[model samples]
Target: MSAMGILSYGLTLCFVLVTFYFLRRTFEEKKPLVFDGYYHPEFKPVADVFRQNLLNGKERGGSFAVFHKGQCVFNMWGGYADNEAVRPWDKSTLTMAFSASKGVAAVIVAKMVDLGYLDYKRPVADYWPEFGQKDKGNITVEMLLSHQAGLPLLDEYLHLRDIVDNPDKVERVLAAQGTVWPAGTDFGYHGVTYGLYVDTLVRKADPKGRDIARFFREEIAGPFELDTFINTPKSEYYRAARLYTQPMWEMLLETLMSTRYFPILGHYILFPDSLLVNVAKAVVEFTKDMSVFNNPDLREVPLTSATVTSTAEGLGKLYGILANGGTAENKVLLNAELVKKLATPLSQGTDSVIKQENSMFGPGTVIMKNPKGQLMFGHSGHGGQVGMADATNKVGFMYITNYISINGLGDDPRYLDLENALYKSLDNHESNIGNQNI
Candidate 1:
């Protein structure tokens, strides 16, 4: 062979070897960002499975936290916050935990009830007179929180511009829409509408006229030193997670067919004559573009029902307080009586909005049912985020992620695996609830 040809062949061989090395490294398991906790020896498998999930590339960016009796038992994070996988997810990374915001919003309202400013049995119109319009004067606060007020859908479509620029107009429209069913008759998931209602009611009921966003900041998030937020501040914007959008074909299929992800519009498109089709139509109009989640302006708007930025630790801490009878950091945040009410189930059965069976709801929270079919109070977000408090077990569990998934209604496999680990770990402790105020 000529000397020039030999040099070219050697160069090609070097290139192939380098490419192979990189490929092997890409397929290797990634180390978790943070893993700290004390679990029984038996719970090793739980940690192993969690690590295996990252190694298998099933997760992108996320965090999981478990608090037993106000003490953090397990806290773990892995993956990247950005879609480009350049930024490693860490203790500070935050994302929109979707419906988990509902649980936090409910906690604020429950505190209001504890302070004697609101009553679940009283008509919501008693505080906000305008809300009494359209024969809604009799809808009680409890009924609305329990997803039973029957005003889950809006009669008119809403643009994001309207929700951001002129919430009052949207509020007025909500006040005027008649309930699809009589108040307290049946139940349906209110989806995004509940947030608007709760926002309006909290502002009216608050003596200082603070809106839900402000109230949560001053009363809950700030006082508790939580990293969560209803309207994420500008300074924290850089730390927000950039979610991975689903494959185009999958998104289109879900947008056209699934009610859980697509909201009311998908259902209306699939079954126009079905019950609550108008609600679906309204949801479709509001969510006409899923790009809204990717917009930076989303952090500026306070969509408490679905758009609160939070971490697993933040969510778990909040739920841990609730699980410990509303006391955290030696502060009595909620009265025991009110805590009991929050834990009580207000509605159960097939949810009209999601079209799922055995779904349970409480005021401002999604009461999750375990594999055993027993209801535990908490909430799950649209992607794969979930936060739940088992008062009986004194366990507050949270899982947050950036790798968006479609199995939103407590069926996500990652959530199930973590949930199983949580249950098994419970056997290692006698009872942590007695000694700690957390």
Candidate 2:
């Protein structure tokens, strides 16, 4: 045989072997993931449904956890945490649960409200006196949480770093803008700013004036005994889930135009004057080193919206508190009355840009209100972390996917909109059962 022909054959043979090796590594699975301690009588059906619907590898990867009566009835995750990891996505891998972390921030703020340190009606200026400047003095804490504070996206100039490490950077950027409309006359989604609101409220209220990351530790996250956290620890670095993005985002230059798939890193851009939210960002900027991100100290930096990582158990536990009447063990996270307040749907208006009708501005959460007024409130993190609980049914749940997004929707190919649809299903099902029981 000619030398060239032989070389070509050899190259093709090597490629085939490499492909087979990876394929075998991916498909060969003797160890079924530890989904639950044991099977549940009720969840056998539910598990079958999730296995058929959410799992089965149709989606890039996804997982779901359901907490019934404060117990995890169904918890399962199966897929690649990273396509390269060769490790199965398990219960321990944490995803950045996007806006869902805002729900967490809301809980922290609500705790302060419960302690009589804050009133939603109070002007933000009351605490941070400088916030009163630039006609912002009248902007209420409640308005900020509800996304009706009249500031939507941050000024375009600032990047994620400006918000994380610099003090007064976010405030200066935002305060420069005029209100979109008079504050509180109409409602819009705060998106990223929601984290800033919650963070600000927590700092103003905490005796030590703790920032966002610490609030997660001292109040909501650490207290819940979940692995979830806004700022990831260097010690826990090995277990942290790595992230990937849709191709469009990776394709763009730093100054490139936005696309449908461009994940607003830190959830909705590096909003400036986002006092609380950026303080919570603990994401590893690059490599395995936790200190790669701007703030290495968990106490100093915060990226409340886009940075926290959590397992299903941790998120479910936090939601369990909201599902229950505001108490997780000895700690009373919020008053029962406040959970009602938190869940109360703000007036629905066109989202500043997303243009969805179903979105309702709640503190940290977007209230899932159906046409019939059946309500289920939970938070969704940036990638595929989803948690929703129907308080009326006393069920709280969490689903975290290391595969953040494939198309515009989460990585799950099962239902393009499964995050919202499943939530609606839980609300509808519970409402029907309630009506029948009554």
Give all candidate RMSDs, comma-separated. 10.1, 9.3
Error of 2 at 76 (Å): 1.5
lDDT score for candidate 2 against the true structure: 0.60
After superposition, which runs of candidate 1 have C-alpha atoms over 4 Å from their true positions?
Answer: 1-44, 249-269, 273-291, 371-374, 431-438
Q: For candidate 1, write residues 220-242 as lDDT tens digits.
A: 88888788888666778888888
- Give candidate 1's error at residue 310 in angstroms: 0.6
Give the TM-score of each candidate: 0.84, 0.73
Q: In candidate 1, which residue pairs clash?
A: 264-280, 265-280
Per-residue alpha-carbon lDDT of candidate 2 for residues 24-89, written as tens digits (9 for 90 to 100): 657955343323333345355555555554334434445666665566655666555656656666
Q: Where does model 2 exceed 4 Å of error?
A: 1-39, 53-56, 175-177, 247-301, 369-373, 406-438
lDDT of 2 at 379: 65
The most accurate candidate by lDDT is 1
How many residue pairs clash (N, CA or C atoms closer than 3 angstroms) in each of the candidate models, in the order given? 2, 14
**Local distance difference test, each candidate:** 0.76, 0.60
